[model samples]
Target: MLNQTPLWKYIMVLMVVAVCTLYASPNLYGEDYAVQISAAKDSTVDLNLVDRVNAQLEKAGIETKAVALENEQILIRLNDDSSQRLAREALESALGRDYIVAMNLAPDTPEWLDNLGGTPMKLGLDLRGGVHFLMEVDMQSVMTKSLKDMEGDFKTSLREERIRYRRVSIVNDVVQIQFRDQETLEKAEFFLKNRNADITIVEQGELTLVASMSETKLAEIRDYAVKQNITIMRNRVNQLGVAEPLIQRQGADRIVVQLPGIQDTARAKEILNATATLEFRMVDLDHDVRDAVNGRVPPGSELINDQQGVPQLLKQDIMLEGSHIIDANSGVDEYGMPKVSISLDSAGGSKMSLGTKGNIGKPMATVFIEYQATNEKNADGKIIFVPEREVVSVATIRAQLGSRFEITGLDSPKEARDLALLLRAGALIAPITIVEERTVGPSLGQENIDLGMQAIIWGFVLVLAFMLVYYKAFGVVANVALTANLVMIVGVMSMIPGATLTLPGMAGIVLTVGMAVDANVLIFERIREELRDSRSPQQAIHHGYDSAFSTILDANITTFIAALILFAVGTGPIKGFSITLMIGIVTSMFTAIILTRTIVNGVWGGKRLEKLWI
Candidate 1:
């Protein structure tokens, strides 16, 4: 009775280990090098598309293992990396822009295991080889835009308050307002200072009020811009079909993005580097477009060209931004032409209502704006990104509009669909330029996996050997628990959707093996001490486990807290390592204390012995 474990508890422990083992089995089957073919906006994937792909691959003399349609897409399994590359190139060339033929890794897990919701833990970029991008938020652009917005707000506020000002402009990064006289300027300064505490207002000359944001306010803007861009980048990355992409803030103004399963760096860049947004503004009906084109651009008006190269004068004031769009769907309208139905958030809806309530029968143009990075650098050694604006759609407001609207001037369904996708993904707050980019091939990822696996295997084997020789009978029990701990780690990682296995995470597993045995070491030493004090084998074993548990629990809880901190503050690989370390801590605790004790009691408990093997 001293060392015996309850029969029901023993069965429960076995059941847990068995379930973990079942989930862990999928990782062993590995993955296949394949290409995924899916439909684009104006294309469809069917048997005919598959036939065309087969013909192209055959013509190119590329060998493929199999081509099958699954999940509304076509998956072509290839022999190795070479064939995967060739197959993708051939398919892309044959399919043209209509279909998307991207590199994909198909899981080779058995159908039965897959049906039971068993999946391998996803690999990180470092372990799986993909594209990595280091993007820097354009803080200069952020400050400029913030000041521009502030200038607009100030003008609007002054007009609403009936404060007279001759002109309000931004010069040398400072917003300067020339008032009619000192009384108005003084009133404006006092009103602005009280209304916008973050904005610093100063008297410039006799009748001018100069305003600029305080340092703290500027810093807040920069932080928000970076954070917002990171959020938008995450939305864009989802559209790229990446499984485990890492997008995290790096330093103060830069972001690091790692796509673990993507091999196409060009496609990723095309989506992430450019910031595309929509601006809704009233068409300048009162201004002559020809006059504005002749170097006479009106105040608060801009001359923007449409897609057909027609110069159109539009109001500079923005009614709504694309960032407020909550949803968009592409379809045909009454004339069977392409259109996009849009839905806005509550604030956007209110703003839309305000902008359109009095502007009925007036045309509102949707300007598609994109910031593209150029090869030239500015004085700050940062890449220059130029904005490209084009009026894509111009529709007259028939009635008061709220959250819902439709754009009908799109040239094709493809364009309509693309517009909808971008709107749904949300727009970047500020432009971001790719300062650095690198692509990791699957081969390199495989090499990393192989090396990481070797380290784990070697560390594990050494641990097993050391335990067996030093502790003898109890060492065998410890080794069994160690093995179970490793299995449970993999199983738990596989079961958790957010857990991704990286190169550094494997090192965590190696560390866990040692910690798993350390608990057993404490218990065995306690047992030896009891035996030396002339205690019976059964009593020694009982006191040994009971006494060591407290110390083990204390050590593990502290270590678990440390791991949590690392996970909370760390990024990328550090996060991956911390995650595995945390999982390993929990599994090791169960195996070393409860599991190993259960095993030890069942093997050597309730024995009458004078001496102990441990």
Candidate 2:
């Protein structure tokens, strides 16, 4: 009974190993070379596209393992790398310029295992090969936009307070108020300074007041712009069907994005760089569209073309900004036509309600505004955004629409879905330009994977050989636990969402193989000490494990703390390394202590041995 483990503990141990082994087995099956097809914004993806792809592959004499349509994309698996390249070329030629055809590696996970929520660990950009972008937020544009909004608010507030102002305009990132007299200027300055804590008010002259954001406020604006752009970029990247994307703030006004397993850089750039928003404005029913088109636009109306290229007149004042939209979904209308249902926030609802109160019968136009980069670059080596506005929908106000509404007259379901996706991705607070971009090819990624695997395998083999020769029979037990430790690490990584293994992460795994046997070494040495002191084998094993527990706990806890610190403070590859190190520490502790002890106890627990093999 000295070293005996409880029956329940044995069952628990076996159950854990079984589950881990089952999950970890998927990685052994390897991956397949595949080509993926994604539809453009106006195009649609269906089973027909899959059939066409198969037909093209067949015509090209390219053998394909399988073809499946999933998540609005067609994935065609090929037999080898040659077939993959040939299929990609053939499919791209067949699909023309309407679809994005890219090479990818698809996991060959069995259907049953996939259904059971079993998946291989996700590889990072460095391991799987993808595109990396370093984007810089336009802080100047951010400040300008903020000042413009503040200028509008200031003008509205002064008019409501009966404080007459000659003009309220934004100049050089500051809101300037030109009042007719000093009394009105003082009143406006006092009101604005008290109302907005983030801005500082300065009396410029006898009848002028200047309001600018404080330094702290400016810093906050820059930080918030970068963070918000990162979030929106992440949402947009989801449409690319990337498995694990890394989007994070790099500096004060820059973000680092890594898209793993994405070979279509053009499509990725289109999705990430595109900025779209919707504006709700009253249509100018009194103004003639022919006159507006001929450059005789009304005083407060602007001429814009709809999606169909027809000119229309609309009020310049925006009743609701796209930022007020909370959610959007694509669905069929009552007449079975494609439509997009949109929900607004509280402020947006109030604005819509008030704006539509007196204009029930008037038509409201939903103006779609997109800022696209031009082919020309500015002096600062940045692309300039050209503003493109079009009226996507013009609907009559059936009643006072508030909070929720639907935009009908969509050309197709694909258009509706795309509009919904754009709305759901949210509007960028400020435009961003990619300052640097790098693409990691699949061959290099495979090379990294091979090297990483070699490091892990060699390290494991060395450790296994050493333990087997030194401790003999007891070393075999340690090796078993060590194998279990590795399995559990991979299993846990696969189970956790957003946990990606990078090159440095593989190094962490290799290091874990070396460090995993430390506890076993301590236990075996302690048992030798106990046995030399004339204790029985069972007593030596029990006392050795009991005494070694404290040392193992302290050592592993300290290392784990370091790993946590690294994870908290590090970025990108450092973070990946820290994750694996932390996970390895945990799994190693469990396997080396509890698991190895269980084996030792069950095998040689109640025996009286004359000699010990350890």
| TM-score against truth, every candidate | 0.82, 0.88
Residue-level lDDT of model 2, residues 455-565, one tens digit each, is: 999889899999999999999999999999999999988888878899999999987777789999999999999999999888899899999999999999999999999
Candidate 1 ranges with C-alpha deviation above 4 Å:
2-8, 36-75, 95-101, 162-166, 178-187, 203-207, 283-314, 323-357, 360-366, 375-381, 390-421, 438-447, 470-473, 531-538, 603-614
Whole-model Cα lDDT per candidate? 0.86, 0.85
RMSD of each: 4.7, 3.5
lDDT of 1 by residue, 393-512 (tens): 787887889999887777888778767876777768778888898888878889999999999999899989999999998899999999999999999999999999999999899888
Best-performing candidate as measured by lDDT: 1
Which whole-number lDDT from 0 to 100 does residue 485 have in model 2? 94
Error of 2 at 347 (Å): 7.4
For model 2 the local lDDT of residue 564 reads: 97
